[model samples]
Target chain A: MRYEVDWSILARPELAALLIDGVRYTMIVAAVSTGVSLVLGTALAIARVSGSGWLRWPAELWVNLARHIPGVFWVLFFYFAFPELLPATWGSALNGWTSFALAAGIVALSVDNATYVSDIVRTGALAIPRGEWEAARCCGLSPWQQWTCCLIPVTLRTVTPPLANRTIHNFKNSSLCMVIAVPELTWATQQIESLTFRGIEATLVATLFYVTVALALGVWARRLERGGYRHWRGAGAVWRRERGELARVDSRR
Target chain B: MVELISVTKRFGERTVLADVSLAVQSGEVAIVCGPSGSGKSTLLRTLNRLETIDAGDIRIDGQSLYRSGLDLRELRAKVGLVFQQCHLFSHLSALANVTMPLVKVKRLGRGEARAQALALFRQFGLERRADAFPDELSGGERQRVAIVRSLALRPKVMLLDEPTSALDWCLRAEVVANVRALASRGIAQLIVTHDLDFACAAGDRFFLLQEGRLREVDNYTLACCAPEALRGLSSVPRGRLQAVAA
Candidate 1:
C-alpha cells in the first residue's frame, strides 16, 4: 500500500500552535525536572556518603527503590495512584486541578532521574582523594565548608559527563507523560496524527527535537569537562594586581 | 608551639603510636625519621586530629586539642599540614587553591584573598604559575604551592608529611631552604621523612620512631643509619653497613 506524504496538514494555524505549545510544555517538564533532580540528587549523594547510618540507610533505600521501579510506573503512579492515596478532599482537588498532569510528569521524572544522578554523584564523591579533604581541613574549613568549597566542586566536575547523560535521558523521558495525557511533544504529535493523518511528519519533528537537544547536551558536557567555562580575564586582573603588590614588597626588601 | 603528651593511637590489633611525646617551639624545625609503618605519619596526623588518639592529649599554642570546647576547624587552621602528594585542589588554579581558605575560612574579601595568595606565591617564587592547575604544575611547583596554601593562613605550626617524596635532590635542597625561611618567620615545623640529607640540612632537632615508640635522636645516629634510611630498608648487612660507613 503506497501512501502520499502530505505536509499541508501541519500548515494549519491551530495545528502549528498546538505543536508549539507541546514543545513548550515538553521543554518545561524536561528543564524543571532536570534542575530539581540535580539539586536533590546531590543532596542524596551527600547523605549517602555522610557516614552516619541514620542518613545513609534512608538515602540508600530511596535511591534503590527509585532505581528498581520503571520510569513509566513513576509517571502513572504520580498522576493516577498518588492523588488517589491522598485524603478525599485533597484527592478530589488535585484530580480536578487543570495542571495536575503537568505537575505529575515533573514530579515523576525528577524522582526517577534523581536516583540515577545520586548514584553517579556518589561514585564521584567516593572517588575524590583523601588528600583533598585533608587539604580543605588543614585550611580550617568546617565539614560543611569542605564539602561546599572543595569536595562538592570536585565531585560535580568529575561527574559532569555522566550527569549530562542522565539529563538527556530525562529530557527524552518527558515523552512518557503522553500516557497520562500531559500534552507534551509526544502527546501533541499523537494528537496531530489522529486528527490530520500526518503521524510520520509529526513523529519525525519530535524525534529531531529530541536528537538535537541530546546532542547539544553532549557538547555541553564535553565543554564542562575541559573546564572551558573558566574565565582567564579574572585571573589576568588578579595577576596584574599581584605583580604591582610584589614590586612594592620587593622594593621594601 | 605544638606539644604531644604521651599520645597513643591504635588500629584494630596494631598500635601505630605509643606514648609518643614531642614538643616543638616557635621558630624551631623538628624532624621525625622512621621506616615504613613506624607511626611517623600517624603521629603527625594526631597533632591535627586527622587521626584521633586512643589516649593522651595534644596542645597547640597552649590550648588542648581534644578538649570539649576546642574548635576542630580552628585547630586545623592554626596547624597547617602539607601532604606528600601536595593534593592541591585539582580543579582550582594555584591562586585559587591558596585563596580559598582565606576567603571562605578567614572571611577575607575576594580581592584581599587574591592579594594575600599572590604575595605568598611571589614569596615562594611561584607567582608565574598562579593561574595553572595542579596537573599543569611541576612536582616541586605543586609542593611549593601546597606549602604556600598552608602558609597563607599564617599557621603557628606546620606539619609536613614526606614533602620531598616527589622531589629530586635539587628540589629537596629547595625544600630545605624553604623550611629555613619558614622558621625565620617564627612558624614551627614538624616534618616526617626518611631523607636524612633533608632532615640533617633542615632539622633543628631530630627524633626517631620505631616499634610504635618515639625518642629523640642525634644527627650522628641519623648519619649512621643513612645507608639503610636512604633505601627505606629495615635492615642492612653488617659488612655492607661498615663499607658504607667507612
Candidate 2:
C-alpha cells in the first residue's frame, strides 16, 4: 500500500533491446514525416499565395480540411479507413504489405503537419510587403528564382519557430501510431507494462525520450529564429576567423 | 524610351488612372508630383507594369510590354522601380542584396557579382556597411542599397517612388544626386513624389497628376490643375493670390 517505485525491470538486456528498437522506430517516423511535410508544406504555401487560381484553390482546400479536422482523426483515418477508400487492387496491395501501418502513419502525419506548416509559411511569406516582390522582379529574378532565392529564405526567418514547433508536435504524435499496433515507444511501454507489471519504469523511460528530443528540437529552433543564416558574410563571418586566430597567436607570443 | 499609351486602371468601381499617357525618353528625368491618392505612384509604377493597367499599351523601345510574348522579368529588369520605403530584403546583407540579381538572373559568377556589388556599394559610400542587414543600415543607406541593387542589372529606365520622402536633408541630397547622375549617364528615370521643390529641381520635364489625369508641370499647368474654387483666386491681386494659395 506504500509508495514504492521499481526501476529493476528495465535492467534486463531484452528490455533494453525493446526500448532501443522503440526509440529507433519513433525517430524514424518523426524524421520521415518531418521531411515530407516540410517539402509538401512549402509547395502548398507557394500555391496558396500564387497569382494563378489553379494553384491556389486545391491548396486552399487541402489546408482548410487539414486545419479544420483534428490530427488524431487523420491518423486514425489513414490507419483504418484510407486503404478501404482506395480502389480494390490498391487496397488489397496495401493490405498485403508488411509496413502498411508505418507508411500510413507517415502519410497521415505529413498531411496533418503540412497544413499547419503551410499556414505558418504563408503568413510569414505574406507578411513581406508587395514592394519586395516588385523589387525582386525589377532586379530581373524569375518567379522561380524570386521565390526560391529571396522569398523562401526570408519566410523561413519568420516561420522557423512555428515550423519547428509543428514538427515536434508531429514527433509526439508518432506515439499515436501505437494505437494501430506500430511498435513505437508508446507501444513498447504498454507491452512492458502488461508483461512485466512495472509500467512506472517503462513509462519514465518513454517520458524521458520524448522530453529530451523535444528540448533538443526547441534549442535548434531558437538558433534558427535568431536568423541571418541566409544573409551572406554577416558580422563575425568566417573570413574574420583567420584574422581572429592570427591576433590570438600574436598576443600569446 | 518607356511609353504609356492610354494606360487605364481601376480598383472595383473606382478609377485610379484614366487614359494616362506619358513618356520617359532616354537620359530624361521626368518627375511626377501630386498630392497623395492622386495616382502619382501608380503612374510611375505603370512604367514597369508593377501595377497592371485595365486598358492600355506600354512599350519600351518600341516593343510591346503588356503583350504576351514579352518576358516580364526582362521587362522589369529593363525598367527598374524603387519604392518610397527602402524595400531591401530584411533577410539579406546589403552586399547580398546588390549581388542577388546579378547572380540569379544574369547568371554572373559569384565573384564577379560580389565585385560589382562591392564596387556599387563603395561608390554609394556604403563601404563599411556592405555586410550589414537592412535593419542595421539607416533609412538613407537602405535606400542607396535598394538603388544599387536595381542598378546591378543596368536597367535602361529607373523608377523611383518618393525616394526622398523618408530621408533627412543629407540623405535626400545624396538620393537626388544619385538619381540625377543616373539620368545624366543616359538611364531614363521617372520619379514620383509630393515634394514640389525636389520635382522642380531634378525634373527635366515635371508633371502634375490630378484626379487620374496627368499634365506638364508649368504655371499654366499648375493653374489648370488647381480646383475650380482655387482657380477663381488666380484673377485676384498678386498678394491676394499668394494669400489664397497659402
After superposing the true interface residues, what Cα RMSD does each candidate give?
A: 3.0, 4.3
User: For candidate 1, lDDT tens digit of each residue in A22-128?
Assistant: 99999999999999999899999999999799999999999998899999999999999998899999999999999999999999999999999999999999999
Docking class of 1: medium
Cα lDDT of model 2 overall?
0.80
Interface RMSD, model 2, angstroms: 4.3
Best by DockQ: 1
- lDDT by residue (B26-56, candidate 2, tens digit) is 9999887666787878787777777788998
TM-score for all models, in order of appearance:
0.92, 0.87
- Model 1 interface RMSD over true interface Cα atoms: 3.0
Every candidate's DockQ is: 0.57, 0.41
* Candidate lDDT values, in order: 0.87, 0.80
Off by over 4 Å in 1: A227-253, B225-244
